[model samples]
Target: MLDSLKVTVLAEDSVPYESPLLGQHGVSFWLEATAANERRRILVDVGQNPDALLYNIGKLNIPLAQTDAVVLTHCHYDHTQGLAQILRAIGKRDVPVIAHPSLFRPNFITAPFFRHVGVMQGDEPADVHAAGGCLFPVVGPMQLMPGLTTTGEVPRVSDFEEVGIALSTIDANGRVVPDTMPDDIAIEARVKGCGTVIVTGCSHAGIVNILKHSVRPGERVAGIIGGLHLVEASEERIAKTVAAMSEFSPSLVAAGHCTGFRAQAAIYAAFGDRFATMGSGTVFSFTA
Candidate 1:
């Protein structure tokens, strides 16, 4: 059986009216799907502010008990900070927490001006004490459920994809150093009769590469959802990314987060109505 999927943004730059929810500078996606005769719910990336995450989830009236698992794409604070709150909300249930082993490494990348913003240091894994959940380390592509899988460590395929982004982690000497994004991964869902939907939380590992790695050898592309992380791209980089994306023939793109408004404009110009904006309070459903 095919799954019924709905992606709701529990936190984003904008909030829905009547919800009185405030927007935070982070990204989190709440996804639910029914597959293999069972209803499955997964929270991909827990967002930064717990209050905002909880408020939006409550405002959306999502049943916390229904959540089956929590997948942290990476150890970035914006993506994993509110995990504790989510586990608390779920109560008593011990779900699996899938992530890269590096996710628990301390002193990951520091934001451009992290000192001024007073964000927590990325040294420890987010606390999940609701029922003492387990951390499932993943490397390379791994099956999450029946039709859902994680395209682990996307390859850098284009110059524009890594333009000017110098990611780093603290070394053994505790000095900030340069590093590549080995922990980056994207979630892929094989939709029945609709092909696949490759969802990412900031395509640090190239959006083009994520789509290419999601398939076996020659599978058709369906949709590309989530952040493309093209905020500070140069015109040349943007042009190249747009040009390459066209070849994949994705049906729809629900992109946001670090994608930036300017980048989205360029994408809209190239892809037209196929471009989608993802944020808090947004919902995407897939039915079989």
Candidate 2:
């Protein structure tokens, strides 16, 4: 039986990812979480370009048929754009697509003053059929696979995270609605002795919230991998984040994607070598 899980970073902006796998822009990550003698692969987000998504998958030597499930952090094209090409690979593989149900909404990417640039142009697929088909539409917290579960919409409880950033969508009725990014979710894996590894995307709800909500009040957090959304964060916010992270005492901090280089540097400065870099191709083995 499976006694451990392995994680692989398929695509991202930093680390050793191949530029030719996908266009230089956009974010996509492929994670292979294995346990027992079987392996299950997950596409955290598909890149903006279909070709890059396919190429990256091939370059990584990850078989398309082996993808067990596809989880989206949100509906943004950068996160879900690759669904089209993926659907063509396995020919309607009945894999479960996990994410907040709101991801399927129409005009989900419409934001004011930046509609053209928010979601990648020409990246939207006409339908899920064109995109890959997902069997289970997870709206809240639930066990997705063995030792793997999704942390449904994270609660926003930190004041330091409010740096006056606008993340919302404009409705057809001319309503400018605040974007809660309800579709945001994180994958939590329990590692034997090592504790829990939280794999987050964008962390739109706030990384602290994602981490806090993913585990019980007293459970130890072992490691964190993925976007911290600290690219434009103020120093105060960063300080608060660092302070909160210090409590987790994670063995490693593999930060990337929307995590600004400056923020990554700051994290490294504070945590020293405990903070490591993660990108496409980076892998971590966990023992149970």
Candidate 3:
């Protein structure tokens, strides 16, 4: 079991403090887990800009070289563009990079405007290998540490939750298809005395669906952090999401990045004191 979990926001769309930390249209989190005298450091999502990630880490006094593993929540540029730089910063060639095989496929958003939002073009896998990092492509749920696991491909059972029209990808036949974002995964940890804490990236798989797929039977969710991807959601959709989240009654909900102000307000109204604002340089510590 995890004795405690510390999550530090290394890069985000906003900055809560007036420090020299850099902010961008992305998200990155530094996770530290301790269990039975063993400590594990993990990086979830690298953000879009390497400068921001590096600067924030330096300002936060985080040791970049100590990361045990790097996990990508999806293939979106905002969540993965800085992977190579991060690997270089760690200065290790054998670090493990856990992600889905489908992450490299061409993906983009086309609703409001057409733009290529996939991982940076040209030889990302090769770059990772050149950086001396080994890639672990997963298709199903897998455990990374003693009490930490990835949700893998979340099953979409929520009727109100559906992949938006804005996102799509190219098929093998060069046909454009709706990108279901199967690679969108979340980190789930069983905190010894505090139940479970779920950490997400963009939550493109749907936060409700992710929760249903991640939370085990008889387990309570103590907290949830990261983007909900409700920036462009309708009022009805936001309301439904808030209602579903209430079922888990998470003690803490720190929403940021793709979670827009409108959705954040609704979540705040619903979760009340349980909701905490998140941004670059934000630090969350949970103990058993």
Candidate 4:
């Protein structure tokens, strides 16, 4: 039912080319899917700064008013901070905001520095409604469109892919506990003839694990894009991840944001020509 898909990087950590696009320490993607002569525009994340996202949208000539929905991969501030601004940009249209139920939980990064890393402080639910947004909190796998679905809560089955020691969350008793990132999710698009294309954010739940939990048996993964969360990973762990990814033999692997240069290098060394350069303003298109 899906004929084509186009993904434009709206905000990222870097912009490699000579363009007017703005860059930020966050991630956002403009996803457009076409099926049966109908087109759907979706915003994957809003990034940390509204100005950056708005600037890039203008530079890229994206119509914010046409956005059908917004999907948040997790509750991280970098991904959820710009939601209000984006809603304001969309005007009076009540856009659907899809995400996991635990996305609003208090989260923090305790390692490098004890800092709050959850969504923006204040009444976010009210903010969404005031900005004309309908929140769809999902707990399991659910379809967003004809051939597009969310990975839901990814299971950590891979031993090598750790959630990292920096992530922590507040428990019900007001105790700080390790955040397993159960709310971490990704977008899965089943292209008519190109197989599945997986789009992720930080991959805090692990990329390989997300793939395993989302992809069906015998379904080939055509490509993978977005953050791999391997910036702070060990060499051994990176190697393991590369090995697991190699098994899928994806035609394209475009990674950026929190993926880190070291992990990207390893992935490049492994995938060679299949590894596409990724950053802010990068655009990728696939057609059946």
Task: Specify the highest-lDDT model's number.
Answer: 3
- Alpha-carbon RMSD, each predicted model: 2.9, 3.2, 1.3, 1.3
> Which ranking of candidates, highest lDDT first?
3, 4, 1, 2
Off by over 4 Å in 1: 16-20, 107-123, 129-131, 172-175, 216-218
Clashing pairs for predicted structure model 3, backbone only: 93-132
Candidate 2 per-residue lDDT, tens place, 10-92, comes to 66775464544444344665666656666667767775666766776788787778677777777666666656566667565
What candidate 4 gets wrong by more than 4 Å, as runs, is none
Q: For model 3, where is the 10-residue window of minimal lDDT?
A: 161-170
Query: 1 or 3: which has the higher lDDT?
Result: 3
Worst 10 residues of 2 by lDDT: 116-125
What's the lDDT for residue 90 in model 3? 93
lDDT of 4 at 22: 82
Instruction: List runs of model 2 lying over 4 Å from the truth.
Output: 15-23, 36-38, 106-112, 116-126, 130-132, 162-165, 171-174
Model 3 lDDT tens row, 1-288: 799999999999988867678899999999999998899999999999988889899999998899999999999898999688789889987999999889888888786788988889542899988886799999897797878888888999999987543788888899999889888999999898898999999988889998898887788898899999998888999999999999988989999898889999999999899898888999988898
The sequence of per-residue lDDT tens digits that candidate 4 reaches over residues 132-151 is 88899999976878898888
Cα error of candidate 1 at position 45, Å: 0.7
How does residue 2 of candidate 1 score in lDDT? 43
Model 1 residue 154 CA deviation in Å = 1.8
TM-score each candidate.
0.88, 0.86, 0.97, 0.97
Instruction: Compute the lDDT of residue 71 as modeled in candidate 3.
Output: 91
